[model samples]
Target: MTDLAVTLLLFFALVSTAIAIALLRSLFAVVMLSGVFSLLAALLFIAMDAVDVAFTEAAVGAGISSVLMLGTIALTARHEMKPKRWSATPLIIVGIIGAFLIYGTLDMPAFGDPNAPVQTYLNPDFIARTPKEIDVPNIVTAVLASYRGFDTMGEVAVVFVAGLGVTMLIGGSGGFLRRRYRETVLSRKDGQA
Candidate 1:
């Protein structure tokens, strides 16, 4: 009961933070709220006993992501520009996708069901094999590093690609772009004087 209450509270907080992010016009507030949202999501993951996932969310989502966004904002605008016009196409597409996702979840087994396929099969297999196959003292480390190494590598590659994309988008040569921007501003001021 206590766990359920905590999970529910975290879920509520996550939703509230998401709504606030969507509604706000200030980029700085949005970035900070995004960090808060990530922290709330990390708490939710912890509540679900996924400490590894929680740690990743806190580090990447809350910490690194927030810092990157702040940097981007520093190079861009503090406030979001007002939209020229509102369109329902995006809202409709999102609604349709959300409905499909909810429908897909309807067929999933209940959370923490003891008889679930993963619980009955994979868990025992991993537990039994960890000591012999991997010889790693920490089962979690063994599983993540050896058993699911390719998946982990893929995730790392994704993060690397995302960071590279952000860097390219911000400025291909980050410091050079900043220097150019400063020169442009100074030159404009000199011309005005």
Candidate 2:
């Protein structure tokens, strides 16, 4: 009962933050709200007993992504340009996509169903072998690091590239643009004088 309540709270908070992000025009405010959304998602993962996912979300989604977005805001516009006219077409399209996605989930088996594929075969295999094969006390870590090594490496590489891209954006082109702007203005003043 308590977990359900917490889940509901987190779900509502996540929805609220998403709505706020959508409504906000300020890039800074949207970035901060996105961090809030990541945090709520992390909390929800924790509530669902997915500690690894929670940690990843907290670190990647909330931490690095937020900083990168802030750096992007520093490089770009602070406020979204006011649209001349709002259209309902995009919203309607999104609604249609969302409805289709919800419909797709209708065929999914109910949660915790004993006859599920994972419960019947894959999970039992892991439970039986993780102790002897990997010798790791925690099966989740062993599976993530050992069994899913290539996938984990791919994830790491992706994060590294994302960080490198953000760093390059902030320090490379962005710095050059600022310096060029200042020099151009100074040169214009000198030319005028």
The CA lDDT of each predicted structure is 0.91, 0.90
lDDT of 2: 0.90
Q: Which stretches of candidate 2 lie over 4 Å from their true place?
A: 160-193
Give the lowest summed-lDDT range of ten residues in model 2: 166-175
The per-residue C-alpha lDDT of model 2 at residue 192 equals 100
Candidate 1 residue-wise lDDT, 77-186, digit = tens: 99998989999999999999999999999988898899988789788899899999999876878899999999989999998998898777665688688889999999
Candidate 1, poorest ten consecutive residues by summed lDDT: 166-175
Candidate 2 TM-score to native: 0.82
